[model samples]
Structure formats: C-alpha cells, structure tokens
Target: MILEFRTYRLKPGTSEDFLRVMAEDSVPLLEKAGLRVVDFGRSLVAEDGHEEAYLIRAFSSLEEHERQEREFYGSEAWLAGPREAIVSRIESYHTIAIETSEEAVEALGRR
Candidate 1:
C-alpha cells in the first residue's frame, strides 16, 4: 500500500475552524475519490505557532494514487470549496510501504 502524507499550516487563530471544515467537508470529498484519511491532527506547540496537520491515505498502488489525484482536482469539491480559505501552506509526500510491520500496523489500528 502507498501512503499520501499532507502537512498543513493554518492561518493564525484558525486551527479550530480548519479542523471543523476538514472533518465536515474536505474529508468527505476525499472519501468520494477512494482516498481515506487514516490520521489527522494539529500540533499543540510549533515554531512560529503555525499549526501542523497531516492525513495518511492508503492506496492500492502508485497508479491508483495518481488516478485519485486527477479525479479529485477535476471534481466539484476542488472547484468550489472553503478549503482555500483554511489552508495557508501544504506539503505532500508519497511513500510506499515496503513492510507493514505487525507492531506498527497494530498500533495504528488501535487508534
């Protein structure tokens, strides 16, 4: 499986609003494209007070991930959305899981 990691920095004092919008709107939109939000949260303390959030999406393969991105950008969710207002900066990473160590996978499952 492949994981898509997205790190975000929200505008000052907008962490709560950002999380709410992500939960109510952004997440659902991604779900429609077969991208699952395995994890997401904000940092309690960060340099410059810039909140950090991340999402882990599991993909069947690299090709599937690419297809999802294409569909996501072309969808209505991307064309018109409140996400533009909430996110200040975004960094994305695509990783391939060579081994789903039992302990690691189990730990994540518990959460």
Candidate 2:
C-alpha cells in the first residue's frame, strides 16, 4: 500500500473554518471518489507563524493515487463543492506519498 501525507499552511485565522469545511464537505467527496481519507485536521503545533494542518490517505498504488486524484480534483463535485472553501484557506501545501506496510497504515489509523 501507499500512504499519502499532505501538509497545509493555512492563512492566518482560517484553521477553524477550514477544518469545518474539510470535515463537512471535503472528506465525503474524497471518500466518494474511492480515496481512503484516513485522517485530517489542524496541526497541534504551528510553524513560521502560520496555521498548519495535515491529511493522510491510503491507496493501493501510486497509479491508483494519481488516477483518483486527477478524477476527483477535476470532477464538478469537488470543483463546484468544497474547492473554494478548502482552497481559499490555504496559503500553501505539499504532499508526499510513501510505500508502507498495511500494519503501519493500520497503526496510523488507530491514532
């Protein structure tokens, strides 16, 4: 399996709003698109004086990840749905995917 870790640097004062939109709107869309949507929320600590958050998703392979992301991000459900609410809060973001054990992913999910 592959585990994707996404980190977001949110605009100042937008963490609460962003997290709400993500939980309410973003996560359902991701799950509907067949993505794992493991976990996501504002970071407990901040860096460089900006709000921070992270999201994790599990996929069977990198190819599945790419395809699913392309389809989901391009679909109207995302573009017309939470896209604005989700993207507008972010100052920047980055994503990294790594190969890992199912056991490791399960351990992460337990957190």
Clashes of each: 0, 0
What TM-score goes with each of the models?
A: 0.72, 0.96
Give the lDDT of residue 74 in candidate 2.
95
> Model 1: per-residue lDDT, tens digit, 4-107?
56666655666777778777878777777677556667756665756666566666677877888788877777668755744443432234444344444335
Give the C-alpha lDDT of model 2. Answer: 0.91
Clashes of 1: 0
Query: lDDT score of model 1?
Result: 0.63
> Model 1: which residue pairs collide?
none
Model 2, residue pairs in steric clash: none
lDDT of 2 by residue, 1-111 (tens): 999999999999999999999888899889888889888987888986789999999999999999999999999999999999999999999999999988888888833
What Cα-based lDDT does every candidate model obtain?
A: 0.63, 0.91
- What TM-score would candidate 1 get against the native? 0.72
Off by over 4 Å in 2: none
Task: Name the candidate that leads on lDDT.
Answer: 2
